[model samples]
Target: MNSEGDLVHGRWLDAVGRDGVQQAVGLLDALSEAHTIRRLELPVHTMLPVVLRQLLLPVMIDALGLPRTRQEWGERFHRGRFSEDERDRLAHYLGPRYGDRFRLFDPQRPFAQVAGLEALNGETKTAAQLVPSVASGNNVPLFSALSEADELLLMPGEAALWLLHVHCWDTASIKTGAVGDPQAKNGKTTGNPTGPLGQLGVVVPTGETLYETLLLNTPIWADGLEPQDRPQWAWDERPAGLGCMPAAQPVWSERSATGLLDLLTFQARRIRLIACETEQGTRVHRAIVSAGDRLAQTPETEPHTAWQHTAKPKKGQPHRRPRRHTSGRAAWQGLGTLLAMTLPVESDGPYTSLLLRQIADLQRGGVLSGRYRLGVETSGLEYGTQSAVVENAIGDDLPLPLRALLAQDDGLREVLLECVDQADQVARALDGLNNDLRRAAGGDPLPRDKGSRPSARFLHGLDATMRRLLAGLRTVDEDDEELLERAQLAWEQCVQMAADREAESLLAAAPPRAVVGRTVKSGDKEFVYRSGKAVGVFRTRLASILTRVAEERSAKGEEAAAA
Candidate 1:
């Protein structure tokens, strides 16, 4: 089928066809659909046509046990609107084999009362009407949909999928518009969303082999599900705060059929099975990855603002601590810290997860690192409260020597991305320094240094060094070598500071100098007392060494300034 003829439902890929539609339908007849209730949360940039033509439509057809007809498939999976006769026919057809296997749970359904089917107002009050509340949780439509099923494939909303994929499960709100409101007068005049919609959640099965279960059983299915070679999908370690990217958030198209068709045909691609392999005659796996510009990935990040906790002043009251302003950067850091601590740590696999897939692309492009750890210092944790309804279980502490890169320029995402790409070497270099610090400190140093002096020292020095280097590097001129000289001098000063700090630590342990005075040798003069030669040598050498270092740095600074 041509991409132009693809259809979508609930922002999910459905079916694609035109001339080859019948051929695709025939292909479905051969594959037996494992009776699985699979739900999917796809991205806005998901390639609908390919996903439909390659993965989903076949699964749906087989799962429903529908006849191999393009029209029937279209009516159910593609169009999603069915006539009374069609519904009756479908029910009748599947009745013998699967009695009442399919049903919809409407949250708006009225409760059955003792007074027969008749009601006082003859109206069905929605779940919201039954229970009114300002909270998103309270407003959610709570109804039993899959309670009876012991095993069901659960897919989340787009946000939830990204969260799980990235291994970051920060609680957040999803705004969905009001549905079927009689008071809505015009198309755009509908009131704000009813409440915050939450991502679909599933109980994490417990076992020693938990990860294996997750990869195979997760609802996020692709074509060619063959178990081999340690299951292609592997967990990729991403830094904190990359989960909720606003730029690549999925947006479902609300266009007319033709417009949507154009969108599908023009801006879509998918993963196709190329081959399968067995390594060492034991592990087996399918190769389903594609190569091209068509597989370009979209960035995902959590969109959240930093909150400022301020204390209000009152008349005749003691002054309160100032509120901390939360910025976007801080929010991201928090999420990153959470994921770093929580997610599994692994290296090799088939890369089945969407998050893992994206991470691979990012790593290849040098946008993401393969290793990350939590910070030992945090601003968002509450410790010790034996109670119900606990929030933020992980105390707010991060691994010290934090590895975060913020934009030197104003908050422009493009510039920030470029900065990150260019700073890969710098990041690696600093990572080495952090490792050194970690080894020296034994664990995260932030906990021991309650005053954060070491962190402050390292960060300030790093900032100055980077800024100087960048300034010098950015300076462009044929003959002007002044900025470069300045950069070199700045780097030398940084090295000098480190050396001096080390010297100071070593000197602190030295035996205290004795203030002993020696009597001048005697022959004639009787009583001239002088300080010991050892004391004088020690003072003079130390002073000379420090003086030389200072003079050299001063001279270099002056030369650069003059130039």
Candidate 2:
């Protein structure tokens, strides 16, 4: 802060670690320009920890100054001009509000811990209990290397990080009922979400820089707090308030987030850190964790998620809820739900996440240029049976050009999605071909269709071509029919070449038995499963699926011209 006490500044790519500005800046810089971050050598999962993102709205509000109306919001970014004072405020919120520390056991106000849990003599749980990676309660460490870490002792700094992680993502088993919490029945709370972020398939919009990234995620146009559904509540920071978010008392309750400020900084758990003296210094040895305030993340208030809409819902009025990410699915494979103006009937009628839709709005409104490529980052956890285990964490970044996501270009979008559909259909046919050849050889079908490695490989092969077409769509002007033709033709050619290579590999790997063929009962009818016959069948299916998509696109274009 300067002499006037009104300034702060930090970028996502900062080289040095500055206190209160942003943590992990140097680490992020080291891993800069990475197109994907799937597995870390460590056990931690998820992209940005909740603790870092919690201060997002406050910084955006203070420094970036959101325009009240949605239209103005788009225009403001389009004309990225600001006064010096505005820049100062931006600097202020980019980090902590002057003087706030990230310490876990701060004497004045400990980081994220409820004010009086220490005085209340809250029952303490192991420091490991605060870690999501550790197998606490009855959660058996079936897989993840994250499950077997040093759980015995935690330095206060490391303990604070885990403390926040527990509050944000602790599992659903059972929680210790702090002595003062009235909501705890028999000194326990159960069945709450593993954590708020755990429940949400978080969708983040990224740009070349952090400025564009944060603004894209912030939906200035929508009102998150609707009185009818979710009502807003206040948060008190007074030490006497004994609540996770510092209320009159700690209570497990549900409420609506007033805006971005509260939504990001949601008090998901009541946590207290126990500090003990170690030979080195103060180390956190134990903790108390209880259920805290509950805030539902939806397309309306929470922008970073996909939603599924129901028109004639069975119970309440027609509504939408956050859509979960499917494991083993690529972001581009299900791209329609993220960019299409029209929702696929099969996936329900919800629009894309409010963030994406808003981005589309900005694109069409000239807030973003046609060629400005943006990275769409989607992160979600695939949980095991009964939501007890984390099967896998999914993170995929898809680069999409602004022109490809324009809201008004619905016709072009329909064709682009159809192109995606064409590839999907053919890939599945290849999977069938894999099994048919195996069956012909008198071999039992491969588990999970393992024989269809070709199909998976084929899809991976198409990804580069798909990204090119998506980016190349920027060249298609309303009057330039030639550019559009070339783009479509390019994709068709790429798919054919890629499919042929995959088919060649599959056929070459076949044994003599598969070549000779055998008759097998497929469904109800008896069918010959010769390698030659299986290849022909799949090729025929692929041709038909692609032909059908091409014809549909032409027919739609004709219909559009006629209209």
* lDDT at residue 560 of model 1 (Cα atoms): 100
Model 1 residue 361 CA deviation (Å) reads 11
Structural similarity to truth (TM-score) of each candidate: 0.21, 0.77
lDDT of 2 by residue, 262-331 (tens): 5666667777777777576666667777777776444266677777777556775446777777776777
At residue 493, what lDDT does model 2 achieve?
A: 67
- Local accuracy by lDDT, each model: 0.25, 0.60
